[model samples]
Every structure is written in structure tokens, then in C-alpha cells.
Target: MYLKGEDISFGYEKKNRILNHVNLSLGSGELLGLIGDSGSGKSTLGGILSGYINNYQGSVSMDGKKIPSKGYNPVQLVFQHPEKAVNPRWKMKDILNEGHAVSQDILDSFGIKKSWLNRWPNELSGGELQRFALARALSPKTKFLIADEITTMVDAITQAQIWDIVLDIVEELNIGVLVVSHEKKLIDKLCHDVVFLDDINNV
Candidate 1:
């Protein structure tokens, strides 16, 4: 497995558990979706798998080795709200040029224009900002992406466009993706495998 969560369990309070016992595995080039109602610990699992929540029980590993806390690459998260994810002070070009190779074709596909690259986060509309966030996350050097409610703030047209860009990236890079969403329609459309949080209960 490229990524796997083994019998994981965790929560804010020591005695109160949000996720009971969860097990998940995804191989390379796979696109998986995790869905459930709010407070169902979906994002918590994302945090754990992405190495943001380390105090949880069980473990997360890549290629059979323990996933590192400090230097591990190849995994990145695109949060629901782009405003929350993006730095208001950074311009689009500054964000995208952080690491990944940028091209006119890539920008065109995400409905972004080269001319807008110099604009700050607040200058763009919500959907545009979210697309910029997606671009930035995908811009990094990585083989796996955790898209956590990536389309929540965008409209239908923008969401569809973003999904297309996401699929294109996954295919072009042969990357594994774990798309966490509460919307079943989007999951059915984009993911090859679906993992429902309600079935696993608290982990």
C-alpha cells in the first residue's frame, strides 16, 4: 500500500473518542473518497493520515515504513476553504512558484490566466481563490494529494472544472488521491473507491 491507516483511534479528550477504530489503505494511482456527516472525524482522519495528528492511536505508514513526522514529502492537503488555506499576503505567482513547474497549459486548465498570477489571494473571487489553492497544492512536488472538501466554496461550474484538473493531475503524475467530502455526488464522480466513516464508527 502507498498509504495505510492501521487500527487508528483518537479524539480531543482522552476518554472521548471521535474515531473508534479505523483502517484504511490506498495504493498508488488510486483515488479514494471518505464521506460522512460533520463531526464524524473525517478531517481528523485526514489529519492523521497526513501526519498532522500524531497523538492518535495506531499508526500511518508508507511503503511499510513508519511515516516520518518532519521530513516526509509526497503528501499534501487542500482544505475546504481556500481563504483558510491560502496566505493573504502571498501573490498567486509567489504561491505557485514555490516549487512546482508552472506552464500556460496548466493555468489554462484550471481556469487561471497568466496575467492574474501577480494578484493576491483577496483579489480573486472565492472560486478563483479555491482554484488558486488547488493549483498551489498540486503545484508542490508530491505523488499523493488529500483533497479535503476542496469544492465546498466553489460553484458548480468551478467545481466541475477543478475536478477535471484534479483527475488530470492524478493521471499525469500517477498519484494516489484521498478526496474527503460529504457530498456523495462528487465522490461518485471522482473517486474509484469510497470509504464511509459511519460504517467505521469512532476511530
Candidate 2:
């Protein structure tokens, strides 16, 4: 399967545009990196890919069909801010179980302990909360993963651990991935191909 975003144009307001005619694609078992500055609409594009933002003028398709508007999305997104993405009222176990029941192997790979599941979102640190967010996104139904600066706030060791787990799953499932980040080394090491936002975005 292939995930494709073609000629995507979006703007916050009429006077100016953030992304213009950006084109991106990731095939099964392929890893694509999107590199750009902070406000270059990298996250916005990722949002579009995952059906988070739908006001753009373009088509996002998987294997030539339009992405489903209802039901579980084949594409999943993991954001940089764990606190903003999750429901503070729910415990970690509830959060992880919202979409699907994640495997113990996945929890182990992400370094999520059984005890952490009993705590509230505030009870855990930022890094710990992020692990839950990631586990939620890594459901079995997810075929594509868009990581929008997901490791930006974590420690180096934690970052490495997450990537190690993610890469393992990517290889195991032949999952397509889009890594959106400004870090050149991270993109270089994890991605099979790279596209700078300025090179593709007409704006």
C-alpha cells in the first residue's frame, strides 16, 4: 500500500499561505523524512495526511482510493506535545485502551511499565506521558505513522529507545512512516528519503 498527498495547498488566512502545493508519498516499508523550519507547515501537512485537518485543497489517498472519512483511520499521528494530545482525566491504561488493546511487547518496547498504566496523565512525567501517546498511535489498524517532532522534548536516551521500538515495529509490519523534524541527523539516520519543505511547498 502507498500513502500519497498531492498538490496540497493550505493557509491559516486568505492573505497568506502556509503550505502550497506540497507533494509527499510513502510506500509500504518506506520511511520518508520531511525537513523544514518551525513554521513551514510540516506539522500541518502531517495533520492533513492523518485526517486531522481537512480544509486543504488536495487529495490524500492510499493505493489510489480516497482516505476513509469514518471508522478507524489507517494513518496515525504522534505529536510532539504529549500533554496537549491526551485527555488529562483518563489514566494511562484507559488512554492506551481507547483505540485498541496494545500488546505487552509494544509496551515493553516503549519502556512503558505496568505501574505507569495506573497513574493519571499528570502523575507521569512528560516523557512517560509521551510513551502512552505513542502506544495509542501504534495500534494494529495503523498502517502509516506521521511523527511530528515526537522526540523533541525527551531526553536523548528516551529518544533512542522510542526510535528503536518504532523501527522494530516498522520493519516487522512493513509500515510506512513520515518523520517530520528539523534535525538533520535524525532524518538522515531513520529515513530512506528526505524532502525539504521549501523544495516542495510553493509558498
What CA RMSD would you report for each candidate?
A: 2.0, 1.0
Q: For residue 118, what is the lDDT in candidate 2?
A: 93
When summed lDDT is taken over every stretch of 10 residues in candidate 2, the lowest stretch is 132-141
Give the alpha carbon lDDT tens digit for every residue of 1-203 in model 2: 99999999999797789988888889988899999998889999999999999999989999999999898888998999999988989988988888788899888888899899899889998888888888878777889999999999988888887888888988888889999999999999999999999999998
Clashes of 2: 0
Clash-forming residue pairs, model 1: 9-203, 19-202, 19-203, 20-202, 20-203, 21-203
Q: Could you tell me every candidate's TM-score relative to the true structure?
A: 0.90, 0.97
lDDT of 1 by residue, 72-191 (tens): 356777788778776789888887766565666667778798778889878888888777766666643566788899888778987898788889977887888999999999999888
- Clashes per prediction? 6, 0
lDDT of 1: 0.81
